[model samples]
Target: MKPTGTLPLRAGLGLKPEHYQNALDAAEKAAGGGLWFEVHPENYMIDGGPRLAWLDAIAERYPLSLHGVGLSLGGPEKPDEAHLARLKKLVDRYNPASVSEHVAWSRLGSTYFADLLPPPPTRQTLQTLGDHIARTQDYLGRQILVENPALYLSLQGDISMVQLYVEAAQMAGAGLLFDLNNIYVCAHNVGGSTQDWLEAVPADQVGEIHLAGYTAQDREGDEVLIDSHGAPISGAVWALYESFITDAGPKPTLIERDENIPPFDELMKEAGQANTIMDSVARDRQYG
Candidate 1:
């Protein structure tokens, strides 16, 4: 039972508990509110709670995208069946517009790192990831998007990351949630051109896009970019996004701010900026 279909790519926000009602109200008012939201499924994996109730209320009106932080799909072994079961339950209950997880794995042995960690691009790892994605899609009875993770260090691997992602997408019948910021961060940390990576990845497989802020730090007299998701989307990443969207066409873009969240109005302002860019590009295409 593959997911019935993907939600239309439109501007959206990450549904935060503190701003749930605000989102609902904005939706009701038909204000500058975004058309949908992406949430970390792990947050709502609970048996029951007011959180679920709030999500239900807003979801009834606006579309939803379930973004999972765990699952460890890139692990050396199969994905966590229990986690997949919980995700499937969420999909069943909410009938969300889309579901996605990161390309990085988080668990090893019995311990969880609580962060999206990287894996080498080895043939073994690619096969393992492809299998995991296939199993996840089968269990959920729907398609899912695998988001690219920000790289922090260089590792010797079996295959190119783009090839691994493409193969995984093909085998799993999954989509790609192309995160512009992640690519920029990875390119900054490692030595690769963001444009080249963009061209290598299968654009048609990208069903959604994510934009977020990052932090710049220096280590060993070298610069490193961290996917903090804490600040505003940077100009360089915005340029990259513009180039990609110009030809890839607009996909549902999200403004992600997980930490140091400013007021709702401030975030909305950022979303508005993205929406404006998308609209301008779309209008140009229609008229030109």
Candidate 2:
């Protein structure tokens, strides 16, 4: 993808309190030309608190990525107005270099599920998602990126993944936050090739790349990969990521670990692996 205005960011970590000081220290240290941090805006969706304080501190030193997990842009209903306003406040205060949300819908009627749920890819769903994204952008007064959700079950859907996502990006004037781990998980679960998905997606619309861990479950003796960002990235996923880096070129790659919280040093190490790979890819691109 050809990054238009913003200069591409390198590797970064999803911010956790355990690693906040480490992120601040890394921002100051510039070890390997520094690292960036992405955060779940929902965690900081408070009126006033230490979370904002920490965000301000780290954001001052490094480029921050505000990735939202709960926008529910693909719901059968319109996007929540209050949520949009709160998200806009965060965007205005931080002026984050990048902002993103998932493609999955989480809320049905008034009930909200904490986890992202799959949406049937119909034309109606795409229209709703596009409108929600556009409204979010209008409220935030800027462009946003839409992340591909990890799949669990194979559902009968009308539109293809790439087609719906590409159309949504185009209609909403948004970018794609490509998650390699999710692509692998979905492909493995739903019986498709990751390469085909990548090739079909409009590469220029991709703004960020995510690398996370997945768990393999033997569901009735059939292996299914779950997008559990709890542990270190797997070898196969990393190999696929490397292949994408070589072909698609580099973007702002992020190491995501949302569960099984670990020590600061360990999390930093996970982020460091992604950093090393992105840097190597950049150098290869430059020299080759």
Top-scoring candidate (TM-score) = 1
What is the per-residue lDDT of model 1 for residues 245-275, given as tens digits with 9 covering 90 to 100?
A: 8887778888899998887777788778777
For all candidates in order, the CA lDDT equals 0.84, 0.82
**Cα-lDDT of candidate 2:** 0.82
Each candidate: RMSD to true structure?
Answer: 1.5, 2.4
Residue-level lDDT tens digits of model 2 in 68-132: 98889988878888888889899889888888898988887888898888888788888988998
- Misplaced by over 4 Å in model 2 are 1-8
Best by lDDT: 1
Candidate 2 structure, TM-score to reference:
0.93
Total clashes in model 2, counting residue pairs 3 or more apart in sequence or in different chains: 0
